[model samples]
Target: MAHRALVVRGGWDGHRPIEASDLFLPFLERSGYDVRIESSPAVYADAETMAETDLIVQCITMGEITHEEVSGLRDAVAAGTGFTGWHGGIADSFRASADYLQLVGGQFAAHPGRAPEPSGEPRDDANFLDHVIELTDLGRTHPVTQGLDDFAITTEQYWVLHDDLIDVLATTTHPVRPWHPWRRPLTSPAVWTRDWGAGRIVVTTPGHDPEVLDDPNVRTVIERGMLWATRTASAS
Candidate 1:
């Protein structure tokens, strides 16, 4: 049977939710998934729909989630539905919902750079910088990062408030910027996985732009992670 996947997107447009999600749709379809796309988190409120879903790929940035919606999503995952996403879609979403934040295992606290005078104003530097994603010992052995070497990408380095339960796969160091008063480089998790009941979760914080998703390394990790999550869910 074809695996069932749901792609729910929408929130802060600055993250280019539509374009980023579009890049994954074709790939999911090609991978033998019966993909369903929704623009709202309300879909989580549908118990029957969530039950039928094998995996959920969320692309929503910062957004509010209703209590019922959060409960529905959490219960579904805990019952063995695989959940995976990248960047703000999964990590930075549902800022006000602690339960939702706990479900994902991390919350985006900040990115270590100053925005222009007006927020969302385009800058030549684009609020991003070059950084290397170093694989953890677990990453070397994990299916998602297998055979992958330390790679570099230019994007906003997310400083997340994370739970210790996560099995970190990869990490990056945050350089001390003039605006922040950190005395040393702060190491942050760039990719991670955790178990929710019988389900699986995977998160990577590098796909802020479509171009980042185009990178072979980033794309490969996400694709493998999704497959791993789905397979895990099906086995459960």
Candidate 2:
């Protein structure tokens, strides 16, 4: 039987929701998933549609989700439906919905940029910075990141505000640059997973655009995550 995958995408255009989600369509199709794409979160409120879904891949950033919509989504995941996403699309989405944040286990706080010049002029390319995603012991052994070594990428490095409930796979550290108001270095989860009830969740803080996701290492991890955080994958 074919696995069911629903892709919920929209919100901020800078994240390239359509393109980013498109990158994985072929893979999902080849994986024997019957894919359905929705432009709005209203689809999440349809318990009937969500129930038939085996997995959900979301990519909305800074959007509002109604109480009814979030409730349906929360219930679906708790009942063993898998979910996975990356960057703002997942971590930065549904700012008004606390229940959504609790279910995902992480929230995007900020993305620190480079140091300022002597003139104190804002750099044109401030948000994107070079950082390495160092894998944890769990990442080295976990199916999501197995056999993967640390890799570097230049992009908007997310300073995520996350809880202890997530199984961290990789991390990135924020440097105490002169530009930012911080006394010491801080580390944030670059990639992580959570087991919610009978279901699983995966999130990556990189993927700001297609180029970032195109990085071989990032692409591999996301593809594996899409499969890893699924009801069928868990049962197997």
Candidate 3:
């Protein structure tokens, strides 16, 4: 039987939720998944549907999720359904729900620009600078990132706030550009995985847009993440 995959997308349109998630559909289909698409987190409230799901790929950014919906989703993942996503979709979703944040293990903090700015806010197109997504020694051996080398991407470099509970797969450093306020460099986890109860979760911070996901390295990471995060047959 094909693995059941659910894609739940919607939220801030600036993240291009539909376009971003659409890019991975062919890969999922070719991988033998019976895919279903939902535009709202409300779908998570259905217990039976959650029970049957083998994997969930979310693409929501800065959205709201009901407590019941989050609870249902949590039950699904804790019971062994795999969950994964990239960029703001997974990392910055459901700002109001601590339960959801605890499940994701990371939150998008900010994407600092090329130089110092008077204030900080989300950047969509202004900050296009080259940065390396460097894989760690363990990442070189992990299933989701093994065989992948550090790659350069000229896009938004994510600065995420996360707990040490996750296994860091890759990292990117934020250097102090001339006149920048911070005196030193800061590094953030660019890719990671979390084991939640009986399930696995994956997150990649580089896919800020389809253009970034178009990078072979980033695309491969996300594709592998989906497969690696999928629930095992014994999970039920």
Best by TM-score: 2
Candidate 1, superposed: residue stretches over 4 Å from native = 114-126, 231-236
List model 2 lDDT by residue over 1-236, tens digit each. 89899999999999999999999999999998999999989999999998889899999998899999999998888888999999999999999888999999999999987766679888867789999999999999999999999998999999999899999999999988766789999999999999888789999888999999999999999999999887865543
Return the TM-score for each candidate structure. Answer: 0.93, 0.96, 0.95
Every candidate's CA RMSD:
2.6, 1.5, 2.4
In model 2, the Cα lDDT at residue 134 comes to 96
Error of 3 at 201 (Å): 0.4
lDDT of each: 0.89, 0.92, 0.92
What value does the lDDT take at residue 21 in candidate 3?
Answer: 96
Name the runs in model 3 displaced over 4 angstroms.
116-124
Instruction: State which candidate has the highest lDDT.
Output: 2
1-236 per-residue lDDT for model 3 (tens digits): 99999999999897799999999999999999999999999989999999899999999998899999999999999999999999999999999899999998999988877653468655456677789999999899999999999988899899989998999999999998785678899999999999999899999998878988999999999999999889986676
Query: Residue 116 lDDT in model 1?
Result: 51
Worst 10 residues of 1 by lDDT: 113-122
What lDDT tens digits, residue by residue, belong to model 1 across residues 1-236? 89899999999998899999899888899999999999999999999999889999999999889999999999888888889999999999988998998888988877776545466667765568788999999999999999999998888888888989999999989876665678888888999998988789999988988998898998998998899888453545
